[model samples]
Target: MNSDRLFTRFAIGINAAWLTLFALVPIILILIVSFLKPDPNFFVLMHFSPRSYLTLINPIYLKVFARSLLLALITAGCCLCIGYPFAFILAQLKTRFKPLLLLLVIIPFWTSSLLRSYAMVILLEAHGILNSFLLRWHIISQPLHLLYTNTAVLIGLVYCLLPFMILPLYANIEKLDLRLIEAARDLGASHLQAFGKVIIPLTLPGIISGTVLVLLPAMTLFYIPDLLGGAKSLLLGNLIQMQFLYTGNWPQGSAVSIALTVLMSLLLLLYLRLIPKAQRSQPL
Candidate 1:
């Protein structure tokens, strides 16, 4: 028995060590590289310098970072507004149909997000089906400039991240005790009051989780912004890509990447702290 226990301990230690090496070490490497000076050849130096971070103070990069944050916040808000209703509906579904409904929610994920964004490009173009239909219906005389704008970027982002927001909410809402809602009604609380006080509070943790999931990726996403925003509304992700690929500034790119990672970590910490401890411990 002692030998078996010792072997189990050794196995767990080995797995933990492997994970630290593979994941933690690379992150540390990036942090270190971010502080290093860049050589003319674009390779990072062994010695550390603050120059890369200094470059981040430039107005252009600052604006891009701010825009990225705003876009992410809006995307998270949109997802919450839309996803909550869908999740609520799914929660009320019959048991026999619940799995099918969930499968439908997950089906779009099987296709690549890039493909979906590209499809949006085709649909939202000036002469695309959406604009043509609207024109034919006399909604407007001219095709709207829907593609290659910030609005298009937001639409694409919301489309891509909707599932992430919905699934967590559905998980929580589906397990909610229907009796509690009825009990609130019995206590003379109106439907709106019950939902606002009881139902919304109960689902807060899931909402927070989904917000973090959607916000983090939305902030750093490059493809949708590049395709939909027309490369004019530059974002931090685009700046990072340009630094590495276009400008051949590896250290600067590494610095931007590190900053982004740190910002995301801070946002996630804030989000987690907003959750009440009791709700966090609740069973999903």
Candidate 2:
């Protein structure tokens, strides 16, 4: 018992120390910097000012925020549509190849997402594989003009984040009580009705988890929007990156960062609130 208690205390201490150094400290620094005045020469001044936050409230930045949220929503929605069916099929599979198939899903994580975005460039360029195939098949008379567009950005976000949406859903669906679905069907419910009444209610947690995962990353993945959407499609992430790295405006960047963090925190709070409600509302 002493050994176990010692191990637990050691593990807790390590986690607490790590979080304090990495997560909590960074957040505190950012919060402090957000209230400081931006100095062109120093990057941050000790003088406290709300100018950074005032800048965030400008109409132009508000529009960017709205657009960023919209894009994130679309990415999460697309991931849900694609991931749900795929996860359901994978979970229902009885084949020994399941692990191999799941491994294929995870292989992408072994690679850099930067490389993945560049790979998307190759696929989305006018004469890339996707367009070339379409051209050969006479799908269209002209190259689809895919790269450096919102479409390309959306595709890239979905491609990169789909796995995040799938794994949780697969875990949830694998543990689903199929008999409940069958019972709904036997009670004169159609397939669609049974799905709505049984499968969705039980799988709500997975759907919410996957969506939140995709949504949060979609908001903050700066490189994808930069590489795929071009300057014309600036997002909150791109704005923050520009302020800090390109423009050397640390205060403004931290302000934007705090605003975005608040938005994301609200989503997390919603997740926490809704998850228990979903559990309680699950059909017997």
Candidate 3:
């Protein structure tokens, strides 16, 4: 018994050490690099400085940050709006059909996100199937500027992240006791009232989780915005990319990355405050 207990403790320590090395170390390195001054050549860091952080306050970066935030919020909102219904349906389905419905939701994730965005570009372009079909149906006089627009980016993002939103919601809604809803109805509450007062509160944790999952990735996404929104519609991700590749300013890029990381951490903290302790303690 003593040997078994000792081995268990040793294994836990080893796993914790591994996580610290792989995850914590990289984050610390990035934070350190963000405060360093870039050299004239090779964009190498020579010494620690606060100038990189000061540059983060420039109007251009601030605007990009705001735009990214708005985009993320909109994406999360749309995901919730669309995902909740599907999740509700899935939760009410027969046990045998649940796996099939989940498969349908998860199928898109098997493909690369980059490839999926490119496919959206092909589908939404002027001569693409969407426009062609609309023209054939006489829905429009001409192909609209659907590609290379913010709307296109939003469409692609929602498609990619929808599964993340739906799965969590379905899990939570499945665990919800249907008897409570039935009881509310028996007490003369309307369906809307029952849902608003009972269902929404119970499912709030899943909603918050899905929102965070979508928003965090959406804010930092570069490829979707680059492919669909075009170079002209810049977001924070694009700005960071530019600093690294176009401007060759490693320190500035690292600073932008660090700032985004901090902002996301803060958002996650706020999200945690909204969820009930019981719901949050559930396994993801």
Clashes of each: 0, 0, 0
Provide C-alpha RMSD values for all models, in order. 3.2, 3.3, 2.7
lDDT string for model 3 (59-115, tens) is 978988999999999999999999999899889988787787789888887899999
Off by over 4 Å in 1: 1-25, 135-140, 276-284
**After superposition, candidate 2 runs with Cα above 4 Å error:** 1-18, 277-284
Which pairs clash (backbone N, Cα, C closer than 3 Å) in model 1? none
- Residue 44's lDDT in candidate 2: 93
lDDT of 3: 0.88
Better of 1 and 3 by lDDT: 1
Two-way TM-score contest, 1 vs 2, winner: 2
User: What TM-scores do the predictions have?
Assistant: 0.86, 0.89, 0.89
Instruction: List residue ranges in candidate 3 displaced over 4 A.
Output: 1-25, 281-283
Q: Judged by lDDT against the true structure, how good is candidate 2? A: 0.91
For model 2, the run of ten residues with the poorest summed lDDT: 275-284
Task: Report the alpha-carbon TM-score of model 3 versus the true structure.
Answer: 0.89
The weakest ten consecutive residues by lDDT in model 3 span 275-284
Q: Is candidate 1 or candidate 3 better by TM-score?
A: 3
